[model samples]
Target: MSTVNPNPSAAMLVIGDEILSGRTRDANMYYLAGELTKLGVDLKEVRVVSDDKNAIVSAVRALSTAYDHVFTSGGIGPTHDDITADCVAEAFGVSIDVRDDARVLLAAHYAARGAEFNAARMRMARIPDTATLIENPVSIAPGFTVQNVHVMAGVPNIFQAMVASVMPTLTGGSPLLSQTYRIDSPESTVAEPLGDLAARYPDLSMGSYPFTQDGAFGTNIVIRGVSGAQVEAAMIELANLFPRG
Candidate 1:
């Protein structure tokens, strides 16, 4: 038995000038996309913005309103460039400062490591007034949830940790299931028949990917939908249309 929900939509905002400048490659978006899918949350859009206050605030406002959830990665750190927390507060027109709850957690962790909670490091404790803290197992610095937005770290490991912390609380929908068919012929030869099959199964999504295997070219066709029975039936019809060798 499984819990079923109709639609749980989400958007992701990747905030970093480094990403746009090609100084750092983004992994959080890809990772979150996969994780959200398994949790039955449909990731609708992804936006990449620089470390600017106005830009981050604008993106947060738009995404938070458009989708049921908005996940953001990057810019909540102990550096001057990290402006995500303040921007999120501005988006909701709320106050932000170093909260005692966050400071206590960070202070204890730093003391254990024999590191000083200096001016810059204390920046991690700067959380929005009304936000709830998201536990960060990798680093003592916590992420947070301000309203519908989940502000996470840029580092893949910590971002993943924050995601794990937040996922259990979200309402997920029906799991999305998929089926695949392999055609021995080239993609061009397979396109027409594939289109016809896709037309027949309007409830499902059909995708044909051209791949080169051992110096030979072929297409891998995938059919995906929420209904396993429908997907299985479609796979059978696909095999019949383009008999496998």
Candidate 2:
């Protein structure tokens, strides 16, 4: 696996009224989370906001400053409600205009179909003046990158392609390593021991996921750490605490 010396932290912004209304489900968050983890970047938070201009602007401003990288999905489409590009520009105190590269790509896409380039279609070409284009293989409407913010498509396929395009250019940190063990015991019996283990390993994250199987309640203990050695050490210590199956 490819790893970096210093890990980066990231956050995602999902902007769409459809998502807020439960009309459309979001698929980008999980995909990005897993991808970033493999790249050694931790996904810190995710926010789902409506298509309101103020909301988008506020989220963009906050996330851009807070995370090493901020990815925004949705609101980059060719419609009046697709105000993400403009909102991002305003948040960054930059201008918004039809970018030549984006326009060329979008124009060619429509022209190939012998379709008219109307105002609706032209909206997709509007990009932040200080941003660079992120190529969209699924569609010609390119995503944009400004500072720490990466604007991408809301559609899963297009968004994923854009992420793939940008990931290669980013700097990553040490990949997190994790281990899971199943214990045929209730959480109440293991909570105190887990707590002690967590306190002993300050650098590791310990979590308990409880479930019921075979008409009995049990908990799955997961330990994660940036260092494989540390995680392995913690697993050994945890196993010693509960030697029997």
Candidate 3:
């Protein structure tokens, strides 16, 4: 009998000095997480690194090795600080330059818009030799995939578009099922029973999120599992144990 893997694991690397300095906030990780969850690719980790080449290269190498898929956002623009392509090339020990196809794409895009395809603008075409291009429908400047690492633009809309382009190509697993129950009690009051319930359902993931609403404390219990029946069973037991007062 063949065994099934419920989800393929993934990690994300957010690259930019702007992000580290709080000048720009990252929305890609949030979008990627939701999309991956629905697609059944578990996003296990996320790391943010600055524009430094060493930092980007190290993170790329580490994440690519640790996860089934690695997605990187930012630093692939036409400015001096855009160095993600070079860093990714270094990480994989591959040669990189402005590939003809990528250059042609950008050149045509600029020409149609009556803009200059200057040296700085051409920087977006620099891609590692052994990589395949990830199409960018929002902007003509394409992202690329090197081995298991996918490099995408930093702009939220562009990043989302790139993710859309990349999603169809990946192999997904069984959808993760979940249920949530809100208890009008503090975490302190719910901890012992919740722990006991969690212990009984080893295959399911149970989490308690505490909130303060209108001067009252409450906990939201979320039960998640690949098997809907198992999640429902645990949820039933949890409701029974902690009946709403």
In order, candidate lDDTs are 0.91, 0.90, 0.92
Instruction: Rank candidates, TM-score, best first.
Output: 3, 1, 2
lDDT of 1 by residue, 66-108 (tens): 9999999999999999999999999999999999999999999
If both were scored by TM-score, which would come out higher, candidate 2 or candidate 3? 3
- Name the top TM-score candidate: 3
Q: What are the C-alpha RMSDs, in order, of all predicted structures?
A: 3.1, 3.0, 2.7
Once fitted onto the true fold, the runs of candidate 1 whose alpha carbons sit more than 4 angstroms away are 1-5
Which candidate would rank higher by lDDT, 1 or 2? 1
The C-alpha stretches of model 2 lying farther than 4 A from their native spots are 1-6
- TM of each candidate vs. truth: 0.95, 0.94, 0.96
lDDT of 2 by residue, 1-245 (tens): 12233678999999998888989888899999999989899998999999999999999899989999999999898878899999999999999999888899989999999999999889999998979999998987999999999999999999999999999989998888889988889999999999988988888888999999989999899988788998899899989988766
Of candidate 2, the 10-residue stretch with the lowest lDDT total is 1-10
TM-score of 2: 0.94
lDDT of 1: 0.91
